[model samples]
Target: MDFYLTALVQGLCYGSLALGIYISMKIFNIPDITTDGSYTLGGAVTAVMLTNNQPTYLILPVVIGVGAVAGALTGLIHTKLKVNALLAGILVMTALYSLNLTIMGRSNLPLSNLPSLFTLVDISTDTNLNTFWIVLAFIAIVTLFIGYLLKTDFGIAMRATGNSESMIRALGVNTDKMKIIGLALANALTALSGYLITQWQGFADISMGIGVVISGLGSVIIAETLIRSLSITSVWLNLLLVLGGAIVFQMVLAFTLSTGVNPLYLKAVTSTFVLLIVGLPRLFRREV
Candidate 1:
């Protein structure tokens, strides 16, 4: 039970990453690999700040800002320099590895002894329970904020910029600028996931974000599968499904581990699981 609970918390942590991926891949149709770097950037920033006795509230905005900058750089490279989207993301992600190392001054930073956002409130006697509620509340707030943002006039313009760039551009929308801002917003959310996970895991490692984008992609794909199967079109419901997908993805992994799968083979297992999620749906659809 405790193991599954921990996985639930982790799922919530990665919920932010799923949201970020949804914005980048689903909305903008850009497979931004910057997720790998910006995620660790958030953890790096959070770990450094917490070790230095920084307030949690103060550290969050800084994390978001730094993540946005990393994402915006990718967008700039893609839009202004005429780089392919994939290559631009790869360039920025490569650069962020060194930047993260420089920021941390080492390979890992421990935060076990430090006060964190999870410790700010005591909701239950069990530490895991408290962390669960804190994470849930934070995710809920973020989902609501994003859902509201997507319904506004500016948000509609941003969506338009992604759906039909030329049409939106002809209508006086700055498509390039929108792309930049969209990527920035996407990475900012991804960074927030890093912020939460670092504290939850009690340490931040330079390698923690490696291949992290796969989890996010898997979650988004899961959500997309459900959305298509159900023909759901409401933005709020879609956001909730994304969060649900993140949780389900993590839960599946937790179940796999519980079944005595070798830890060494976890990555391979994850890949296969994601492949099944992606391929099974298409196969069934084709058969039907």
Candidate 2:
């Protein structure tokens, strides 16, 4: 039970990344691979700031700002330089690794003595329970804010730019700027996840973000399935489904670990599981 609760907290922490993915991949139609780097960059920045005894509240905004800048760079490279979107993201992600290393001055930073947002409140005897409520409250706020943003004209423009860039461009919308804003928003959310998880996990590793995008994409695909099944066309409901999906994904991973499989194969297993999630539904839909 405690294990599952831990998974729930971890999932909620990563739910922010899934929301970021939703904005970039699902809404903006960009497979912004910059997530891989920005995620670690967030943790690295936060860890460094915390090490220097920076205020907890100030670290998040800094992380978000850096992530947004990284994302905007990718957007500019893709839009102005005409680099392929995927290649631009790869370039930014590659650059971020060195940048993160430079920021941390080491491959990992332990936060054993630092005070974190999670440590600020003692909600329960069990640390996992405290994490559960605190992370859930944070996710709720983020979900509501993003959901509300998507209903506004600017958000609609971002969505429309994704749906059909040429059409939006023809309608006097600067598609490049829209892409920049969308990617910035997406990466800001992703960075927040890194910020929270760094403190939650008690350390920040340079490699913690490796392959994180796949996990986030899996959460997104799971949420997409649930939203469709429930006919939940409302923006807020869809975002909630994504959050719930992240929890489910982590729970499923915890269940897998409970089995006697080799822990080294976890990433391979995650890839297979995501493949099934993305493939099986379409296979069944075709059969029907």
Residue-level lDDT tens digits of model 1 in 65-97: 999999999999999999999999999999999
Measured by TM-score, the strongest candidate is 1
| Candidate 1 Cα outliers beyond 4 Å, as residue runs | none
Local accuracy of candidate 2 as per-residue lDDT tens digits, 31-113? 99999999999999999999999988898789889989999999999999999999999999999999999999999899997
- After TM-score superposition, the amount by which residue 214's alpha carbon in candidate 1 deviates from its true location, in angstroms, is 0.5
- For each candidate in the order shown, give its overall lDDT on alpha carbons: 0.96, 0.92
Q: What is the C-alpha RMSD of each candidate to the true structure, in Å?
A: 0.8, 1.1
The residue pairs found clashing in candidate 1 are: none
Kindly report which residue stretches of model 2 are placed more than 4 angstroms away from their true locations once superposed: none
